[model samples]
Target: MLIVGAGLTGLCTAVRLARAGLVPTVIDARRAGSGTTGHSSAKVSLLQGSMLQRLARHASTETVAAYIAANRSGQEWLLDLLRERDVPFDTRLAMTYAVTESGAKDVEAERQASRDAGLEIIDVGQGDLPFPVLDAIGLPDQAQIDPVATVRALVAELESFGGRVIEGIRMTGSSFTRPWMVSTTAGEVRAEHLVLATQAPVLDRSLDFARIKAYRSYVLAYPVADLLNVPQSMSLSLDDPTRSLRTASTGEGDFLLVGGNGHEVGHGGSTQARVDEIHAWASSHLPVDEPAWSWSAQDYHLTTQVPHIGAVPGTAERLFVATGYDKWGMALASAAGELISGDILGSAPAYAEALRAKGIRTADITETAAQGASVGGRLVGDRVRLAAPGSGQTPPGEGAGRVEGNPVRPTAVSTVDGRTCALSAVCTHLGGVVAWNDAERSWDCPLHGSRFAPDGTLIEGPATSDLEPVTE
Candidate 1:
């Protein structure tokens, strides 16, 4: 078996197969801990912020119950692995809060949904939060981990089970032929089973990228102060401009992590300004100092609010995919690894079967169409904007980029650190025009969420190919 991606899902599945004596080989474009896993908030809990309520919007009661079961199983499997490997993690309550009326409705709905799904959730107003909330709900005895540490531990355990891991390898796609040859930057290899654990699978056959929305959020970790009133649990706000709070301990000291201010990857304006707002909010609401480290990570959310974990529709059961965790991958991805491995080994449990057996709702179909329509609108609007008066070559200043030319072929031009370059603005995934992200100094697709560096190297993908460098 070949497992692509080295994050939580890939590593966990690799470990599972190797322990079963399958001797799976794992490959990562970067490294085992890169991608979303290393950057995650690392909360292992069933009480994901308004997640159940969101699922209940279009999912059947049985589907919701099955999702809860999947998460619980994922959580238990991960926690057990961490414990057995002697990796240190924290056990605390996980709470969701809302400050606005609409947000309170979401919180209440989530509380009721959890009850229906058989989760012992509590509504205690707001529990031990430094700031006041109109409504809040929680699940106790949840867990949190240092994501990077957890990933490293997982990789270590996988190796101990006689698994092989190769880094700096990118899997482009699989062959159209039988025996299912997998293509990668390293070379082509034949495998009986191929699993794509990458966030929003890399291949475009399923059009899975279009099924999920990509959101980017920032996190600032500040050194703990003498009088900082840190919350004892992982806390999240269900309101617009979401807020997530937790404390993490490192060798230096425990630091307060303030996270939020999420927007779709390429749609938001002034990413730096968004980062600044997160910083200001944290400084106002908590005892924080100059941040020790501040970073950003992006996650995927499905239109139906349910993760899609199964075979790629056209792969004839030879290829499998796992995605659409919607920022709750720490648990969902872990569970996915178990389920996918079980499926391959012919030992998949009831919860895995339940997730696969759930039927799509009319609302799910509508939601998918709406998401596609939003992408279509963006594509049209971007081209129209480019064709406005004075729509010709104009150089951007340092740390800036803009699109030029007509829809036949648009060029993305940028100046970063005094080096100016022009590249194709057309996203290789589906021909959508790419937008420049000022904060990250990259070209991001507003359509399916592919991202490229200033020089046009592929960063994220449903687009396996890089943007072409155009002659200026």
Candidate 2:
């Protein structure tokens, strides 16, 4: 079998299959931990902020129960793996805090949903935050970790079992026969089963992109001292422009991780300004010094709020895909690993069976329509904005990018390190007019969340090909 990603989900799935006497080849576009999993806050908890409430609203009661079961099972499996590997992790209370009245209502709703999903959460008048919180829900014994370390440990275990990991190779396309064949930049390979564990399935057969919304968020690590009074627990906000907090103990010493300020990919402007927004918030709220390092990550959110973890429809079960964790990939992906492995081994659990039972609910249909309308509106609005008279802008300076030329034949031009390049501004995956993400210096698609480098190279997302080159 061949797995086409090496993040938590892929590695977890690979480890399970390998332990069962299957020699699986895991392929990553870059080295292990080069995807979204590495950039996460690394908080693995069943008490995800308001997630149960959102799920209950969009799915059946059984489905909500199944979702909770899957996450709990995944959480347990991960703890076992950590114990076996002897990787030290911290156990902390997980809190969802609301600072505003509106946010308090969200907390109330989530509290009820948690009870329905079988979690015994307690109300806390005050969480260990430097700022005041109106109300908070605390779930004890949740855990945190350095995600990069976890990925490395998973890879080591996989290798010990004779599993092969190939890096710097992209899965461009595939063909299914007696044995499926995957085409790649490195070469062609054959496998009995193919698993697409990427953020979104590269294979477009199921139209996965249209079924979900893609978003980009930022994470900043800053040096903090005892003066900050940083909490020893994991916490997330139920407010807009969400704030998540935790700590990392590294060779450089302990640091604080502040993450939030998410926006739909390619639709928002001034990525640096978003980073600045976070910096300002942290500076005012805590004793956060200038960020030691900052990075960004992209994630997909299913309109239904339930992850898709089964075989790609119409693939005869030979082709499988797992995605839509909605920023809770650590636990959800671990769950997905066990579920997918069970399906392949012909011994799936009842929770897995419950998760797979499918009949589109009213919530799903409504969310799908809303997502479609938003995409459609963006498609029309972006084209008009790019087509307006005098829309062509000046060539961007070094370390910047801008759209030029008319909308019918727009060009994405960027200058990085004193070198300038131009490419078709239209996203290769869909016709959504690409926007310049000043932060990453990449061309990003507003409609479906595809991204490309300054020189027209694919970075991530559903687009299998790089942006087409155009005249400078």
Candidate 3:
């Protein structure tokens, strides 16, 4: 069997399959744990902010309960593995808070939904946070860990079970015929079954990209002088431009992690400004000063509010896909492993059945339509803007990029660290115009979240190929 991607989902699924006596081969375009999993806050909890409440709007009570149960099982399995591998993790309370009256109502709805879903959550209004809050609720004993370390432990386990992982090799294309043939940057390989655990499945044939929306959130880590006053809990706010706070202990030092300033990828104007807002909030609210580290992660959300983790639609049973964690993937990634591996091993769980059993809700259809309209508008609008006279003539200054060329052929030009590179601006996946991310210095696709380095190398998202080099 072949698994594409080596992040949390791919590695976890590989470990499970290997433990079950299947030697799966996993491949990634980059190093293992260097993608979203490496950048995640890594909170393993069922009290996922206001997610339960959001799910309730699009699903039945039982479906939400099953979602929580699946995550619980996933959490238990992960903690067990960590203990067995001697990986260190901290047990902390996971919480959701609201600062505004409207946010408080949402929190109340979340509280009710969480309680109905069998969580022993408690009211911790205006919790022990350093800053004041209007209301809050928490679930104790939820855990947090260094996601990269956890990924390393999983890799060790997979290797011990004889499963192989190859890095820096990207899957370029695939043929779904019997003995499925997958073409990678390195070479072609054949497998009896295939699993795509990437952020979004790279293939456009399945139209899986249209089924979910892509978003990016920023995170900043600041050094704290007094650790005693730190939140010491995983907390998320329900207010606009949501704020997420947690404490992290690392070999370098202990730091307070402040996250959340999420927006649809590519569309979020001035990515650097998003980072600055988090910095401003952290400096003002917490007992922190200069930021020690800052980064961002991309996530996919479904209108159904449940991840799609089964056979790739239209790919028959030979291919499978797992995505749409909606930024609460620490436990959901493990759940995906269990569900997908169980399906392959013929012992899929009941929760997996429930996730797949739910019929499409009208809310889901409406949201999907809205997202489609937005995407269509972006594609057409971007093309028209790029086609205008004097659109891409002037060279961008240092640490900047612009889309050049006309409607028929667009070029992405950027100068970073004294080197200027020009490449195709059109995304390799579904032909979306790429936008420059000021913070990360990469070209980001507004259509499906595909990103590329300054040199046009594919970074992540559904794109399988790198941008073609353009002669200026």
Candidate 4:
């Protein structure tokens, strides 16, 4: 067996298969867990936002039930594995609060759907939370674990089981023969099957990229003296520009993680401003001295608020993909691993129905043009237009200057004391024009919320690589 990523999903799959007396070779472009798993705000909960309601509408009750059961069972399986291994994971019963005024209806509908699916959901007004909640739903046996620790433990276990985890090895592509051949920068890995579990599938042409939109989310971890009245909770707002909130603890102190303000992969504006907004919101709710760590993560968003798990559509026999988690990758990834494993072993999984449900098709070119026109209209009407060269007489900041070229395509020329250096205005993240974030003194991506330091180091992503420098 061969796994393309070494994150939680890849590692877990490798471990499960290895323990069953199969040797799985897991190769990651970077160190294990350094990808999405290391940065995840690992919350194990079945109360995915508005998912049950959404699923119930299109999928059958059995399909929805299987979806819920698979996730719930995956969580139980993880907890049991941890217990058996004596892994010190923090298990807490958490509640999902719908904060918007009209969220009551959504929460009620979701609770009913969950109950119909044979899942336990305690109502907000019921004895679920200790404090007052506007409208909430509680999954009885939810959990939270330190993802880094869990990954480390899993890596150790995989080593013990004689599974190979090779880091700094890139898997470029693959070919299907009798077994399977994965071509990598290092070499070719031949195995019976392949799993593409990377955050954004590098093999873009295999699946509909539009079916899964990339979204970047920010997290600010603060060191608080005490946790205060805020219990271990995870929340999602129902209003437009949805936001999520959750809290976790570290040896230093308890930290609050706020996520959201998402746009399509290359469509949001100003990463630092977004971070500042999160900081401001956090200040009002919780006391913070300084953020212990501030970072961001990106995930694939399914239009239907569910994952796409199975063989890549219109592909050969052995290639499989698991993506479109929509900010619920931790639980969904585990479920995908189990499903993929079963499929490979020639057994049908109970959750396969959910995976087989059709995804939303991409818009046609004419429709796409209309959508682009609408977005362009909004951009023009908005006050904050894209930055351009010499748009105004004043420089962008103390160290930044506006060079004459094109305002829309203005060169971001920087000076150290009084030396000149110029670079392309386009952000490499998603080609959204880059602008100077005066407050942070960094290049900001207007399209997908990636931030780069003054010298062009990636401070945040969907774009893992740094900006390319322009030369005279």
Question: What lDDT score goes with residue 16 in model 1?
Answer: 87
Q: What is the lDDT of candidate 2?
A: 0.86
Candidate number with greatest lDDT: 3
CA error at residue 171 for candidate 3, angstroms: 0.5
Model 2: per-residue Cα lDDT over 168-205, one tens digit each: 99998888463778998899989888999888888887
Candidate 2 has its poorest 10 consecutive residues by lDDT at 386-395
> 234, model 2: CA deviation in Å?
0.5
What is the C-alpha local distance difference test score of each model? 0.84, 0.86, 0.88, 0.66
Candidate 3 pairs with clashing backbones = none
lDDT of 2 at 32: 89
Instruction: In candidate 4, list every pair of residues with a backbone clash.
Output: 266-447, 267-447, 268-447, 388-407, 389-407
Error of 4 at 110 (Å): 2.4
Question: Candidate 3, 192: how far from true, in Å?
Answer: 0.7
> Candidate 1: what lDDT?
0.84
Instruction: Identify the superior model by lDDT, candidate 1 or candidate 3.
Output: 3
Segments of candidate 3 deviating more than 4 angstroms: 314-316, 387-392
Residue 172 lDDT, candidate 3, scale 0-100? 90
Backbone clashes (count) for model 4: 5
Q: Which stretches of candidate 2 lie over 4 Å from their true place?
A: 176-178, 387-393
